[model samples]
Target: MSRLYSDIFTNRASTGQASADLSEAHPKFAVNKVDFWYPGKQALYNISLTIPERSVVAFIGPSGCGKSTLLRVLNRMNDLIDGTRHTGDVNLDGKNIFAPEVNLVDLRRRVGMVFQKSNPFPKSIYENVVFGPRVAGQRDRARLDYLVERCLKQSALWNEVKDRLHTSALALSGGQQQRLCIARALATDPEVLLMDEPASALDPKSTNAIEDLIFELKKDYTIVIVTHNMQQAARVSDVTAFFFEGKLVESGLTEKIFTRPTQRQTEDYITGRFG
Candidate 1:
């Protein structure tokens, strides 16, 4: 294994051992020495962080700082982009996700993602929610219906759209569309959910709704979100990591990172001193 991957694997093992000891008290996800590149450009540095299971971990930074890139790496979304390259390791539950034997499709199913923009399909609300399970080979009407209802409820959109399951997804408001996208993500029953500025384009009301939904979802799924909004990070995340120039500058409890960041760069960015 490369040095980066070796370090990552070792760290994941250590974090897993520690997490096992405190399993009843804390939730965690292990990310160790991860790096990524797009064609000729490197987007992430030697990044290592642990996000507790069932907890919210937020990445906050200015544009081009690799926040979104790191988020994509979590669920292997970067693989969809041609010319992309990666090094190091990203592991969940102590399993190295980049290993050759690991199935990318199954990994993605286990680790779902919500994009910056809400991209709902042209299909009906019900169809959107059932897309994942359907692709996974679930053809039973009853199972699809149950999955749709369950995920929609989990995303806090069932009550609003329950009466109109057959309605076109585009007919919904922007806020509703974003929620619908979230519900679609939940349909897969993923263990980890990655969000990249999921509420950035929504109105304040919608943003608040998304935030509330994130807080609620953490009770079941480990969430890793990348956002440029500092207050949003502080509001929703249990732990916050600050990135600058592709490097992870600092990471700690959200309260501390916002209020008492250890690194000067983190303080500068959070305090609006620099991007």
Candidate 2:
């Protein structure tokens, strides 16, 4: 099992296979030998990955597998917590995001995130969608209206809530609320979007809606999602990475990962032997 995991990293040359070397070929976010710690416990191993531009990459694993931890690292959301330390490099556009001179607020603005649960503020739906732009001091009412409409339309929520823009955001259904959260994230015009189980709490219909939205959004932004749902990862992502016990077991094109993964550990987990 260990040897299976080692082959994905050891043999970096392309073999006319889907799991070819992407880490150095063309990477928008290059994570090289990254290790993370939270006080006494190490949360991530020597992880290296290459996420290309305007693509959707899914991280799949059971709980406590460090998939979500790595997602937060891209935008430096982990910096808000105490006793957290990270080593190695995570470069965006070939620039290190962890450098002392890098501005965290700007980094977060460029990289938006949506949590597992829909956390719409108690504000009106229109207010919720435009909050990020407002914070950036965009005070033009006409442009704010345009921004709100554009983001909501992009997120597939405009048609449902266009008539109720001023209604309380909390009054929407769970699925709609999650979509609203996505609109809010998009309002910031981020280059990269990180989603942690964006549709896990939704009904099947809502889940499909989110999946369709992901398909549309990937054309414009780089997206990384951590989803526990194997089917969701297979459905929505172009590439898939499997992690276990703070280590990335394997990664490849989504179809290949689901059908013919190189690593035994990946195959076992996909086949439901263990997570």
Candidate 3:
């Protein structure tokens, strides 16, 4: 009874197409008329969206507007909640991830995630970075060493922590720990990275580092982030999706979404009239 994501696809049966940015290039992930319910309350309603490959997309809205809920849906994290029910399709590379045949472990490995606060394992820094590969049966120490270095470098944390690889991960600052988490996610060579407020708990300097890392990571991994910082979304994401009351009010290029949203609801929220 593993969890599932978008695993089925059908145009007529689909109910959550929010906007028309579906170009010829198949989206890395597609949310088609997705509706979610938790017990008696509906957290999301008819939400349709698409994520392209090798790009950074941001989900922004007031708290409880389903920004993070939808983010969780990407990796099937929501499935862990009791009495939660979902409909519609969430397609990754045109395959509905919810299909029974889909391997949740493999899906999680390919679609890695970072959370709002750093949650490094209580282990050595080197161990933290190599844990994923090591668990999958990687025992060659030289190969493990190379993987750790490469992943940490990709996450921009190799330089600062190289001298302390054997130190407890909990000893690092909040930013370094978060980057270590990112490095750990990268160790598996995931094609997509999901970040749920990856910088909200850090200082300004740490936030900037995470933002910079996002910029660099976009070249190799398709990224989606849920953020409360509008400015941070603008700075780090190429596309933005604005959610209101669990519905996708508007989505488009970051510039257009910020500067010229066609929907009045989007304008009101973005302009500070209301959230």
Candidate 4:
């Protein structure tokens, strides 16, 4: 690993700060020298990142800087696109995810993802929450009921929709729908949650709600969020990774990366000097 990569696992920030040093946290997912391509162009080059368990890591950079691509790559969401390919390995809990023996379905269940847009199925709210479990051969009504309530509450959506569980999910507001989508992802009992610009489309109030939910959820699930909002990144993430033109420019504690970035490109981007 380079010096920059080594810095990602070091606590360079002072102790009294609000941000805790997460360098010693157990590794949840490790991306090793990954280079990704889509059809005719490359999106990532030699990117390596270590995400600590039960913490939040934010990927922030300008447009087309491979932040979202790396987010999708974590759960192999990029495989759905035609002619998409990558080199190197993405390890989840120290095991290579690219191994042929790995089961994609089970992998995805362990690493649930919420997209840039809220995509609730046409079904009712209750059905949406229980969709993943139901698809996995869970037929017990009582157990499914428990999952519905538990996951909705985890996503902080239970109080608002408790009395209307059977109503169409499409009827909810944009923020509510996003929370529903998060509840749906949670119903799978995922260890890691990958969010791609999850709150970018919502109003300020809704964005704050999502950010609060993220802060609370980090107590249980490791989260990787791809966001363009620098303030949001600073507010919610324990670690921040900045990318530039398909490479990881710098990554470290959110406090250090934002306040004392070691790389010139990282400083420029964060300071609004250039992106």
Each model's TM-score? 0.89, 0.91, 0.90, 0.93
lDDT of 3: 0.86
lDDT of 4 by residue, 1-275 (tens): 22442332343232222454585799999999999999999999999999999899999999999999999898898889999999999999999998999999999999999998999999999999999999999999999999999999998899999999999999999999999999999998999999999999999999989988997898899999999988778777889999989999999988778777899889888778897
Best candidate (score: TM-score) = 4
| Ten contiguous residues minimizing lDDT sum, candidate 4 | 8-17
lDDT tens readout by residue for model 3, 1-275: 00111111121125332222425545899999999988989999999998888778999999999989999899898888999989999999999999999998899998999999899999999999999998889999999999999999999999999998999999999999999999999998899999999999999999989988897888789999999887777677777999988999999877678767899888788767887
Sort by lDDT, best first: 4, 2, 3, 1
TM-score between candidate 2 and the true structure: 0.91
**Residue by residue across 39-141, what tens digits does model 1's lDDT show?**
8999999999887878788999889999989888887888899999887877778888888899999898889999889999999999999998888899999
In terms of TM-score, which candidate is stronger, 3 or 4?
Answer: 4
Residue 98, model 2: lDDT of 91
Compared with the true structure, model 4 gives a TM-score of: 0.93
Cα displacement (angstroms), candidate 3, residue 214, comes to 0.2
**Per-prediction count of colliding residue pairs?**
5, 0, 10, 0
Clash total of candidate 4: 0
Indicate the residue-level lDDT of 9 in model 3: 14
Q: Which residue runs does candidate 3 get wrong by more than 4 Å? A: 1-26
Each candidate's lDDT (Cα)?
A: 0.83, 0.88, 0.86, 0.90
- Candidate 4 whole-model C-alpha lDDT, 0 to 1: 0.90
Show model 2 residue runs off by greater than 4 Å: 1-26
